[model samples]
Target: MSWKKSLLDWWGSAGYKKCSEKNRSVLKAAVSLMVVLFVLAIGVRAEKSVVIIDDGKELAVRTYAGTVADALAVKDIVLLNNDEVTPSLDSALVSGMAIRIDRATDVSISVDGRMLPVRTQCRVVGDLLNEAGVAPGPEDEVSPALNSAVTPGMNVVVARVVTKTEEKEAVVNFETEQKYTVNLPQGTTRIAEEGRNGTAQQIWKVKYKDGIEIARQLVSSKMIAPPVNQLVMVGSGLVVSRGGENIRYAEAIDMVASAYTHTGNNTSCGVAPHYGVAAVDPAFIPLWTKLYVEGYGYATALDVGGSIKGNRIDLFFESYNEAMRWGIRNVEVYRID
Candidate 1:
């Protein structure tokens, strides 16, 4: 009757009953508030739409958004530093409005597994591959065709490169000369002391990548034809001297036998001879002996000049003026010795 009875009596009082009802209403209100918050959250989440970017598609995307940056972020699109974004980040994004993104990237191309360097502005895998510097390998496959467009985050794969190599036959020619003897005069003949055959051959090699020539080997080499022999004759007879004493005399003509100047020196004077006309020995021939020089005109051995020495005869002109005018040159001397 003590504690339990007292607690039951207090609960049965009127103020306690009002307090309990007030507490129950407060609980109901709190539950209702939580439900509203949950519904509000669900509605806000539903407003965010997910965008999909397919491979080989344009970087410029169309969205019903209020800003360009917001639309790109929503679609999870990432832009490279060198990529161009049209309409700017803060530009309003309206329905049917395109947001173009031009991509600039460094692409590596490979031909027959050899790497090549390239820079690309294409957005799709196929375009970038084509822009890659490497030439297409035979039997090679690209993930996208050459005409296909490009897209972001797409990886292009190239497959199996087949190469065909074939050996082509070609010829190399070789030549050599052979010497033999023949008689100049009629009824004379000499022996063919030495002779050699000319050789020629064909070769074949397998060609590899990049049209590189390799595996050079000689297939066949043999003398296709014999070289023609050169002919030479031996001198046999000499005739006796039939000319008179004045023409028959032979003597030595020395350099500087008389005084003659080297008119033509280091400098070029067109086609004329620089030195005085070279003369044969006068002792072997004779001075004032009236001789016909094959290349040069008839000249007299009148003047003894210093330059005239050593198998040389100086011809004198009536005037020193004429001697200066004579050019140095080669002439055949018929001895009026």
Candidate 2:
């Protein structure tokens, strides 16, 4: 029989109906599996809401990425070598997740006479120094301040300051003092105690910055050896004896004595020129003053002569022969008050 005559015979047979029912059940199972697969794909691609804090700026983003790095890559954000990122790039992303990005800056640091270039993501100067492993001393000074905000291409200087005390020796000058006493002769002086210079210690506080001196202050000064004062003794009194009597004379002088007899004229004081009357320079001995002469006994200065100048005296005699006998000689004359 032909193939068309065979198909007509099967249409009337029970085997064809059983095969149709089995094919319908297989199509229903395929449709159910496809629906479940589509639902699972939608769940895996669901968008996640996230917050990104980039260099202190807030940004909201929704991504279907599976990891933090994937999310950032989808947002077209590029990270530099020195830039810092929170929640490492490999961490899985979650709904409502927060991401932080700290951008780095280039800066120069001057410390201890050296310059160093560095890149950091710190927010303040203090944090940058700590990151660089630079620990400043308590007395050190920092420019721009530790709490100041760090900026790109900024220059920071650290001045190394130090304080120290120093001790030094100095010379102390001596002083002089005078003492008046009657034991020393008049118009004479003597050094009773010698003078000597002493030593002193000076303490100073000094400050230095960057190996250079900045300031110095004298803290204290003390005498290490006291100076010895010079003591000088001066004379103020004199005494002498005259004509077997103790005379309290004020002054004495050695004078050249010349003798003169009666000149048959009155003296400069209008007194008679006789024994016990002497002629002297009024500048040396005032008129009417009492005087005691050695080897010539006592006399009164009652006259003045033209040649009787300083340290010269003329004595009166009873006769010219006696005047000739008494020539010129040095004699001590005392002025008695």
Candidate 3:
């Protein structure tokens, strides 16, 4: 049968007769009222009730004909790059729809050994790790601590600090020093012993953060090649006696001594050349001075020669053969006045 005939049959069915006249009348009035209200609601169906959540805060609001972005603008909510939204701002709004915005904050982070440019919606350091998808062990370190509050662009460091002891060898520089001694006469010094640099073995406690060396502390140090202190002996005080007379002198040095003789001619000081006359450097031992040598006895410094300059002295001997015997010899000479 046709759907039209079936509907007419249902209207005349026994079930339709089961209702009382009074009840039927009430039902009929209710149906008529519902139909009229439904038609009126269709004309104003553009308005919707949307729930907005911003940073965990919820606001139930009614909006008139616009997208989700337009609805949030009416509430003066501005979206930033760090802010997040569910169902995106461009999506159309529907009645009784939930719009969630999880706002992100700029945060600094150091993971492992490197600093990271990060932005997250986490509110605490502990939550930050979850947002970063990092699970820290008991030995790992966290800056701003794990339970501390997090703010925008705050410093947060996660380090794995480990310690170990190590042994190392190092060089030590030797020291050079002087020693005053009365054994040697005054105004002379000599290096008694040469110094050699030393070596040492050391134990160090080292600290590494995230596999990078952070610090080291000396635990123990032992000398391997002990440092040798250079020793210099300096003369302190003295007096000497020579030529049947007591003489006082500041110092003595070696000199190249030679001999020249011309018994009859005069010397540079107008004194005739004699066995005791000595041509000496006036700058070192002045003319007309009395001096004594170690091997060659006493002499008078009463003459000067062109070749006699600085630590050089020409002595007078009785004969040329006698002078030739003393060709050149380093002799210790004393200064006496």
Candidate 4:
């Protein structure tokens, strides 16, 4: 106010009013030049803003534009398609206002063993997966958790989990059983009934990951078919054995047997008969061969008889009455070779 008023007062002075028009015009030009110089010295290149890149690099740019996009364009800063800008490009720019840009990256992802291509400007795995259009369930497992940071060439995997109960056919082994009987000869075995394999219907809870089985748990098992016990009868015959309980033999023959007495009788061996001697077929039991009569006592095959053909035998006793009582009976005689 004071300078303009002082200039106007000077212009209106008596000596100035009496001056020519050319002199007045020269004075006006000098005043305009002074004002222009003062404005330029105060405000030139002072209005600018700060821009920060993805890596935290800063750029100081001078621009007369009003918006963020215009400021970036004035500085020749180019942006990629996937890049992001904070405060938007059309936001108004003020002095010392900060601008930020985040560069995009290619993230690789594998969901349920399938590869997926995605691009994003996110920094963590959670954001990246969301951008890639993949979501994992509670039972599913992830190699890298959602909160894990994403980097270049990073690969993520998600495993699908499933559990189910399935019915299956399985086998239950049968047990072997043994029985002893005196009806059969010793040291021999007979399978009364042949053993057969059993069948069972089983239930199981199976777990799978990515369509592959991982674990199994038994839930309930019921026997659909019961196993039949095998029956085997073993011989425990009472036989003449100096070696206890071994009644095995090479061969046996079923024939009729008769009893005789000890006396000076002409026999096959041309010797006097004794109480423990027996006559048998020479082709069956050789002379002097030991013999054990069932329901009778031990004897020696010391003689042969012409009537003792095939499997016939004659056993000698101490008493004639005992021989008559023994009579004739069918017996299977074994030869101990």
Candidate lDDT scores, in order, read 0.48, 0.85, 0.81, 0.76
Clashes of 4: 0
| Per-residue lDDT of 5 in model 1 | 72
TM-score comparison, 3 vs 4, better candidate: 4
Candidate 4 C-alpha lDDT tens digits along 1-337:
6887988888789978887899989988998998897776444434765654544787766666677888778777788757888879998776777788877776688886679876678899988877777888778887788899888778888888888899998887777777654556776888988777688888999999999999999888888777777888777554445436555443455779998786667667777777777898878777877655666656678887768887888988778999999899987676543
TM-score for candidate 2: 0.39
TM-score for each predicted model, relative to the true structure: 0.24, 0.39, 0.45, 0.47
| CA deviation > 4 Å runs, candidate 4 | 1-50, 62-67, 70-82, 93-97, 121-124, 127-133, 171-192, 229-337
Q: What TM-score quantifies how close candidate 1 is to the native fold?
A: 0.24
Candidate 1 local lDDT, 1-337, one digit each (tens): 8754765576577755767677858855876786698876655444333333322365444444457788888678887645667778797555555666756665555455566555467766655765564445665567666566654444455654444433333333333332211213323445434344444444444434344443454544454554554443332232223233222212212233222344443212132332333343545444445443443334444433345555565543344565656545444444332
- Stretches of candidate 2 above 4 Å error? 1-66, 70-78, 93-100, 170-199, 223-337
Candidate 3 lDDT over residue span 223-300, tens digit each: 999889898877745356666666554346589999887856698899888777889989978797776776677788
TM-score, prediction 4? 0.47
Q: How close is each model in CA RMSD to the real structure?
A: 17.6, 19.1, 17.7, 16.9
Residue 312 CA error for candidate 2 (Å)? Answer: 34
Clashing residue pairs in candidate 3 (N, C-alpha, C atoms within 3 angstroms):
none
What is the C-alpha lDDT profile of model 2 across 1-337, one tens digit per residue? Answer: 9754775677567755666777858855875786688886776589999999999998999989878999899989999869888899998888899999988899989998889898887889999889888888888999989999999999888889999899999888999987554556776788999999999999999998988899999999999998999998766455666566775554577899999998789988998788999999989888887888888888999998889998899999999999989999999987763
> What does the lDDT read for residue 245 in candidate 3?
63
